[model samples]
Target: MPLAQRVHNLPSYLFAGLEAKATELKQRGVDLIDLGIADPDLPPVDIVKQSLIRHLDDPDAHQYPSSVGDLAVRKAVAGWMQARFGVAIDPAMEICITSGSKEGLANLSRAYAEPGTVVAATDPGYPVYANAGAILNGAGFRALPLTPDNQFMPDLTLAEGARLLYLNYPNNPTGAVADESFYREVAAFADAHPETLVIMDAAYCELSFLPPKPPSLLQFSKNVIEFHSLSKMMNVTGYRIGFAAGQPEAIAALVKIKTQLDSGAPVFIQRAMAEALAAYDGVNPPADAQESHNEYGRRKALLEKGLKDVPGVKQVYPSPATFFVWASVDDDVAFVEHAMEKGVILTPGRGFGEAGEGFIRAAVTTSADRIELALQRLRDE
Candidate 1:
């Protein structure tokens, strides 16, 4: 069978491959602390689960969902935007529910990118952004190197004719975030470009621990479209519930492509997502969830402390948000492989981009005890 050229060019997700290897080792009776994946260890509130189960047997929910999502789900998403970011969005025209933010982001790229079109993206970014660009075939993706010097934000001034610019905060692999001034500058840059379509991937927005709640693309430009996923915040990665909100025209283009893919996410899932979003404002993290965050915070602290004494480890700082720590380690691939051999799986930064080489991304998803154990193993190695 002839696979699409785009599929041929896309590499397997680095973290995914690492997790698979860890699983293989575990099956062979090796004890491993699997920290390569960013999946939250918490479950959504019981309310969300109960809501889904109640609708599970509803014959109506068994049918295909509305293409862009049921009106209720879209309204919930818009309400979420307004409540969380103070950004008013039109539920009917400016929002679309996707199976996952990943789908929305990839489809958005396909919708807007054409041959010879240039896209500006950050290095050490979520690889899907670049993958999405490559799949457009005619589009050229230029990775704007992200480094400690610039505080991990891309310098838009360096990008030219950039039709699509991808920004991820609480950034994957790095866990770095930009400030409001940075966002304002990006907004001004977008205004100057006029033609550029900014695609902001805010999957980690709800997971932030910093102030100002991480600026939304809507806070910057109307030309921006952004994605959110329940996979992270609601601990429903398997549910594939996510949404895109912003720019009416961009949402319309994505919806057009979406209609041709699968019917929207399952109706019951959308209903459950609505319930989750509705309660998000007041829903305190369950005791277990709270404990998990504490544990992760401890793990991050441990990593920060340990790296301080490790030779050749540089730019080690605590990320104000997200469940991962990014540190620059010379020979990151070697570092990752060495950790894996010691039963602690880590994702190599190089897997994200060339600039990512010599860096290692460690996920803080495991239990505190396990994290401590992993740290010990890391130090011993």
Candidate 2:
């Protein structure tokens, strides 16, 4: 008659009421322009689609895949890392295929965190880093604040002795990115704390609009592990294909836990994702990928310009990465609720952590024309 204690320990879902309100508004014929979630609007590039279609009839697609993933997919991941970041990776020893980066990230804590020790993650970050990681595993959780003064990256030194540390760049919610210099700092931090297994969430690295592109943590740290998502980079979010690569020990630990939990991601999906990863053309993507980045950049610029005239927006955080615009407001909750009433949905920042109390993030994951209309409504209100 009751759920597990861990389920009860989970924090209340912040958007439950928002979803209810949106339903009521839509029922009343209100046209809601949702800018809340970071789901890609575009379909996967042709190569990825054709690959999946071509592989659909393979007899292997119907059978169970290796828990660590098929050799072909792992080799694709290794090649991508080398081409994209000049980072050398051994597919057999260092790569583990994951259903998605979120799964690997949550499982990193499961593999590494002990019950009494803490799992540290950047605050105002993806909730999975805390909820499904530390809390579900009965490990203590720590919020290492990402402040504007630090360019939205917490000092990794603060997480010393932690069982596992989660980091993201071209970050979600904040749109901040890290550079090679910061990664060097990360390397130093890892060296200082050998017990801490640094986990880099590189889901958005390839989607940045800025020049010089984002740097990979692998360039500087052997003590770190990275979970990358083809879903975000290839506009194939539903495919749920990603991989964890880095320190061999970290990869082995995750693969061990994953084996006990379930079989590997669907074979067809893995092969399809391999097509996408193999197509990545170094730091600057090929035609289709660049087009998606450019489109999101335009939408983000339009949203930022519109926010300049909006009533409650105090400041718009400018970072040359991610398809999100983080805006400071007097009160994030009040601002989001007011926008919802006007038929535009956004996520309040405080839902992430206390560090996000005064901000709101806008995901430019819609069409330009629809985004224009949404901004106009906000201006009108």
Candidate 3:
């Protein structure tokens, strides 16, 4: 049997190795406190559940949904975008409800990238950006390394000639947030290169701890396509619902590709998502919003304080958004292995990219007490 040539080019998945190690440890009876994967421990909001219940009995939900998504769901997304970012989107032309942001992103690459085209991404960033490009046999997958000096922002000079540039603010592993000025700079950069399209991964947009939530790239320029996920916002990772908004042409291209990949997301799930989005006010959300934000804040502080006291551990990038703390250490892989031995699991920065070699990412997805315990174990190690 032979595998696809593209599979040969793909690097080993970062989290799969960590997950396998965790399973091995659990089978051996190790009491492991996993801080590696970013899946929130919180349950989906009540509205999401209630909506699904109401829709599940409808026979319409059992059939294949429109590839572009349910009209009501698309309208709800547009409404949310308008209220949250002050950008008006045409539900029929500018939005595509995806199974999840991850699937949307992968398909976006397929829509735009080709053998002679370049896709630029942050080196110590999401692996999907680079991997998606590779799957298309892209001419070049350029990695703009994020470093301390650049405030973890990818230098645009390196991305010259690239057709797609992937950016994640309130970033995944680093948890770094981008401000208005940075977005304006990116807008100007996009203006200079009209041919390039920016893919802004705003998965963590709703998880900001600071005032003035992260701004949408749509608020800055039309050259950008932004991916939004319900996984982080509504604690609905299992639902696999999200949307891609921006550039009408891009949305159409993605919808065309998705039409062949899978029937749009399940109709019941789409109905549930629609209900959740309609009720959400990003500026003044439901009361439960503060609970998760405050809890993550407390967990982040606890982990940061503990890491500060430990020898050889440095809090290199303290984030104002997201539930992740990126720290610098002597050797990320060794630290990850040692932490696993001590019954604590963390993600190595090197797993993100070469630029992440000296760092480690700890996710605040568990309760504060468990985070404290994980911190204590790491410190004692």
Candidate 4:
């Protein structure tokens, strides 16, 4: 069997080792609370489900979909951006839907990373961003470290030769949210560095716990590119519906790159997505879903409480949005194993980046019961 040489040097996911250990425990009949991934347990909206079924029968749906998503879905996305973020998006020129935000980020790297380029992303950030850089021998781009002390936002001064700056607010793992002041600073940073491109990973924007909405890059800088996903907010991860909006140049570059990689999403999926957004007005989230957030909040409180006693864990900050709790921990490998052996599965900080080595990302994707259960196990261990 042969594989691409470029992929041979890539490292296995940092969280995989712990997850494998968790799998081993589960094989032995241990109900290991799997909290490593931020995959939501809820189902997508009913309209989305029905739409998929109805479209499944269409012969056109069987063929390859267009490279650019259908007009309806694009319009829906533009509508969402305008209604939610107060930014007007030209569905055709300003927005392009991707299979998922992860793919959007990966290909986005290819679009921006010319030779001798640097890409800035938060430390303890999502792994795909770093992997994107490694693929092209640093030609893809490098991530700048964003630490807990800085409230998980990168200091513009620390970023050097950064052609692309990738950011996620209501961030993954850390669950941090940025205010208008933070965004204003980012805009100012981009203004000072006109040559640089700011890629905003707003995947979790819709899942925010804050009011007045999360600050958007579009609000501040014309050079900024933004990515949004239906995965977390709508519990439609498997559906692979995500989109990006930004300057026409950046958006056009990404769309061109994406076209070469694969065909676009099915028309029915686009229709369904549009329907989901329309139905969003009257949609009532299930109790379990509502409870999911509350439960995570409770677990966050409990974890923070427990952290006070844990030696080597420091710089604990309260998470205001998203479904993750980031904590600085020494010996992530050992800690993850110990917790998993006691029936808990946590993502090691190193999985995100080298800067994440001293930390762990605790996802609230699981139920509060599981969170409580995992915390108890950690406390006992």
Best candidate (score: TM-score) = 2
Worst 10 residues of 2 by lDDT: 277-286
lDDT of 4 by residue, 1-381 (tens): 898765775777655666667777888899888777788875665667877788778676667776667777889888777666678888888888888888888887787675567767787787776667435534554556767667777777766567777788878767788889888888888778877887789987766553655767887776678988877766778998888887888888887987999798767777767766655442233343445455556666766666555555665667667877778777887777777777878878888877778787777777667777777777774
Q: Which whole-number lDDT from 0 to 100 does residue 172 have in model 3? A: 81
lDDT of 3 by residue, 45-128 (tens): 778888899999988899999888998889999999988888999999999999989999999888888888898888798888
Clashing residue pairs, backbone N/CA/C < 3 A, model 4 = 99-240, 119-142, 123-146
Model 4 Cα shift for residue 171 (angstroms): 1.3
Count of backbone collisions in candidate 3: 0
Measured against the true structure, the TM-scores of the candidates, in listed sequence, are 0.92, 0.98, 0.96, 0.90
Q: Between candidates 1 and 3, name the one with more favorable TM-score.
A: 3
Question: Would you list the C-alpha lDDT of every candidate in the order shown?
Answer: 0.79, 0.87, 0.85, 0.73
Better of 1 and 2 by TM-score: 2
- Candidate 3, residue 334: lDDT: 82
In order of TM-score, best first, we have 2, 3, 1, 4
- CA deviation > 4 Å runs, candidate 1: 11-24, 282-295, 309-312
lDDT of 1 at 233: 76
Tens-digit per-residue lDDT, 3-63, candidate 2: 9988888899988988999999999999999999889998787777888998998887978
Best of the candidates, lDDT: 2
